[model samples]
Target: MAARRRRDNVLVAVLAVLAVLGGGRTILGWFSTPPPGPSDDTTTKIVGRSQLAESFARDFVVTYLSASANQQDKIAEYVSSGQQVTLPSTGRQVSDPAVVFAEREVSNPQLEVWSVTISAKVGKGAGTAVGTSSSAAASTASSSGTTTSASNASATAGPGRQYYRVAVSVAAGRVRALSLPAAVDAPGRGSDLALANQNSCSPDTPFGQVVSGFLTAYLTGSGDLSRYTVPNSGMVAPAPAPFVSVETATVSTDTTGCGTGGGTARVLATVNPKATDGASPTLAYPLTMIFSAGQWQVQRIDPLPPLRNPLTVVVGDATQGPQVQSTPSSVATTSPSSAVQVPPAKQN
Candidate 1:
């Protein structure tokens, strides 16, 4: 009888332990859920892409019209990575997410549909984060580059509506190709401002009074800019940066029944203002004008187009095709000795 009792006690203790372990396992199972899914970040390897390039372009256009200088800088980062962007409109690799949010304020402008192509050049250690430090490493490593060309519809709907496309090209994981503003064309011609002005101001309107009225309306943003644009609002020449004095003005003369579309004598407005660029007062800059609807309207002003240099091509291979030394056959060349040939070379 003693032996049997001992055996029973041992069996009971073993059963209890088993019961505890089973219960613990049950509880753990009830509380635990499956492991969380993998994250969305996929770009880990180096590669070239077209879609990523489109995203960069879309972001750039949005940044161009931004009023806040700071917001613009954040958007600039994707293009240039090193510069310390101080102005809201200048910077690189910005961190602010809310900066690009205000693009909803302005309506997307009417944009033409065009093709955009991007080529990718990715070397090992060639990211903006370490570009300055490891530039040589990136340049020396066996570089893999790809060129991706794609066609996308770039449209601006009316004054503020713009559409963009995003594409992706992958080699290993990183984006290495991109294109921008590949093509541009207006779907339709904009309304003619000259025709629209015929229904508005007139030659009888005094030039000074008109200028003053326009200035006041623009500074306050009160008048309808859709009808008339102001240089102060960044719409016209003579950007309203350095304020100048108005020296004199001449009323416009209307010439009716001379030509079709109601021709009018081109008016003239002369003003001698102090130069912000250190030009002399005797310069007497003459602003070309047109008299329409009995008012003198500015047509053109003095200022050359912004300077742009020709692109420099660096040949990568000596085994490539021979360089052509001959000029294009289409170019008509006369004797270089002529006294400064005028543009078009007085065709025939």
Candidate 2:
């Protein structure tokens, strides 16, 4: 009996030791692992629209303006150089990537939430133009396939519409392509122009209203965005152009690879000014939107016509009757395009 009681006490001591060790491990894991709940902040970095816009502008200038071979070779960094870009003189022909970058102008910066309707047709057209590239060609056939090469290349590219949303991200003050959200398919609009006039064209007929709702939800963290989708199915529609907007325009969507990774939507109608009395002008082009987190968000607004900077020109003749000599004008010929390096907005 004595021996048995001694053995029982030893067993109890071993079990208690095991429990303490196990509990220590569990506590360590609790401390090391991330909590199983929503994070305080999901954005990698929170920044204001002005800072984001200015950063985008600076990157646009540097990528397009830098002179070294580094700048020249860097063309592939933003866009595939082999792809087609409009020449200044020719309409839409494949040209040097540098030339297209050269035309990039980052002025009259405006960032806001507004509704935009993307035409499926225009999306298809841009995709078609981009679909026929050598890189896409290389997808199929060993580097040496001959007769079936081009067609095979197109096939290897996968369907152009599969990638509905073009993901854009700004890192270290430079804009680069990023991963897109999951849902990217827009129910086919089927080449209809008149449909644009009706709210059924999308959740909001005015389109800007839809965009406003999106911005309200995304920027201000208010409002629900379930209806902004293409089919109103509660799923977000993919948009091709996430970063750039064209003027009031018609777009074709039948071609492949227009907005490649992001689905493409074309501009089929013109937008009149939304703010009639504001100092800022109205939208001249259609908008492109991306579906994210169960709602469509405006990623690109249409490019407006260039606004002329206010000038103060004085008409004076140096050769007038009064004895006068020509003096250099006080107005500087080259002023800074924009103030360099506005600090990023301070975070709380």
Candidate 3:
């Protein structure tokens, strides 16, 4: 009996030791492993590469499209000599061609090659005669898949808009080469144009009042946005500080083709940037609104489109204020209107 009890005690001791060791391992594992969380490095390299590609595309397009005396040299700075093609000498100059959108895809990671699609506006310069000449040149380039001289490259590019794809190689944050521009077929208004809708709400209605109040709150950052906008509507909490003020606003309502329950509206506002220094510039803000919860709220704020007037403004700069997001399903269906038509470029 004494031997058996001693053996039992030894067995109990071994079992307890095993349990303690297992528990210790679990504790160590708990300390060793980290809980999952958002990672900043996720797609960081890809995004950086995309930005570089876009920058290269912008520089290449602007330099190639501009009919300047130093156009070839400017383009050569961004691409290889072999890639640099001589543009037509038609003196068809495009002043201030701004990039509207850019899409980049990595084609070869080892070679740092990217395929980029760019949409840009060619501001009016010299007149329709230069426009005609440039359009002709663009048509020629499109057909041959190679940059040709002014004589063979005579075709209309468009009213003042162009979309093209180019292959780019970037290394060490610099553009090494760019392929010849391949035109992307952009026939219709594309996704930039908003579908037309019938007007249902008037400026004197309560919906209009709510819209005005919402705009005031959004621009001034004075009121709670949560009270006016739906949750997850892409509006940042504690609305960003306003860099501009509304000088005048004309509200128009659109009821047709806005989905089932609600409709859309627009407020054409004349705004002035509030600069700390002297002389701030004035701009136009086409605010898209929607009827929600029996009241009007901001759906989207279209970027300042290209304007033909002397007081026209371009809001594409980094210093520009926050852009209003697209409308949520609870609000409407139609996207924002096409950017305002840009006026002719100021001559030198």
Candidate 4:
């Protein structure tokens, strides 16, 4: 009888232990952490620019624009071996070839399309029109390096200059002209940005002095450049500046008026760069001046000018390309030689 009672007790203990383990497991399930949700970050890729495609298109356009009758061989240098270009009966004078627009083909990953623009000067004689761009020759004149070759369109386009856009395709190191250049409209004009001539003061104003000084030093090599720009702006100009003199056209201010103290101001001005007599480039720049420390100083010389119409400039085409008097190796640099006179900011 004792043996039977012990066997029953053992079975009862085993059942109780199993029940305690099951209950503990159920409680633990309630406290367990839920799985983490999906991540929020989704990486997006950026496309890199291809300078080769742009450069090849630019060179091909210049040659294509200036080609005369039966010059298909010249164009074949840029196009595929079997391709031929319709040559003009008479050659047109074109200069300052610039790439106005560029984009890669999404459908053909290897190909890129570029809109190469050039300034066409008046032709001496009537020329046979083989290409579409020549269609504008009826009204074509000349441009001062007009993109106006100087970054800013000169109010005066000498020799009846007209702007031309050529669509070019580039792939694997070769450029292709699938179509002749088309004469398109000049870029639409934006809002005017002229300085308020509110006060009678012209050259004597403090701000005027600062701007004039900056330009004089930058273009004409007249004053010390260090006096006009902010410290640590890595702007550098080649020695023996590009022009003989500079004159500010219109000085404008942002929120603050030019007469009273203001934070920033833009000059709708033209400081003509009188390039040495090869082809006179249009001398103009879109520049801003800021008031810092006790006086006004030029804000900065952008590596690339703003896409909007550059501030108008009126520099007298007085001087030629100056001999690089000194090499400025210490700072970054850009020489505004084509129809514009934007000097990179000077660094100490």
Cα deviation at 70, candidate 2, in Å, is 18
Error of model 4, residue 341, in angstroms? 27
After superposing candidate 3, which stretches have Cα over 4 Å from the reference? 1-39, 67-75, 83-86, 89-91, 107-109, 119-159, 190-348
Model 3, 1-348: lDDT tens digits are 999999999999999999999999999998895877646783687678777887777667766766565567676676667864767764344442333344454445455777776545455542342223344334434543333344433453433446677777866666754567777754343123232222333334444445555565566665565455554568663335644343324333344322224566554544444533433445455667666655456666667432222232223321111433332223332332221111222244
Candidate 1 lDDT by residue in tens digits, 1-348: 999999999999999999999999999989999777644442221111334434544454444323256464443443343434334443223211111111111111331122332222122221221212122222222233211111111121112122222222223323321222222221232221111011112323343334433333333344443233223434433335333433333322222211112233332233344434553332222223344554434444425221112312223321112331221223221221212111121233
Quickly count the clashes in candidate 3. Answer: 14
lDDT of 4 by residue, 1-348 (tens): 999999999999999999999999999989999777534431111122345555666677667777887787787777654654567797776653444545554325576675556544434422321112322332233322213223222333334445556566656656666665566665453333322222222444555556666766787776668777777666666676677756665343332334246477655334545545532344555456666655666777544333323343322322112221222223221222222122345465
Better of 1 and 2 by lDDT: 2
26 in model 1: Cα distance from truth in Å?
Answer: 50
User: Which ranges in model 4 have alpha carbons more than 4 Å from their true place?
Assistant: 1-201, 272-285, 302-348
Worst 10 residues of 1 by lDDT: 95-104
Candidate 4 has a TM-score of: 0.42
Q: After superposition, how far is residue 111 of candidate 4 from its true place, in Å?
A: 7.0
Task: State the lDDT at 240 in candidate 1.
Answer: 54
lDDT of 2 by residue, 1-348 (tens): 999999999999999999999999999988796777634452323333334533443333333333234343444565446644332221221211110111222322331321111111112233333334443333222222422345644664333312122233444445543221122343332221121211112222333344444433333233343444343444332332122222222221221222222343432233322222432222233455553543333445446321112312223422222333332333211222222111122243
Off-target runs (Cα >4 Å) in candidate 1 are 1-194, 199-208, 213-241, 246-274, 278-348
Under the 3 Å rule for N, CA and C atoms, how many clashes does model 4 have? 28
lDDT of each: 0.31, 0.33, 0.52, 0.52
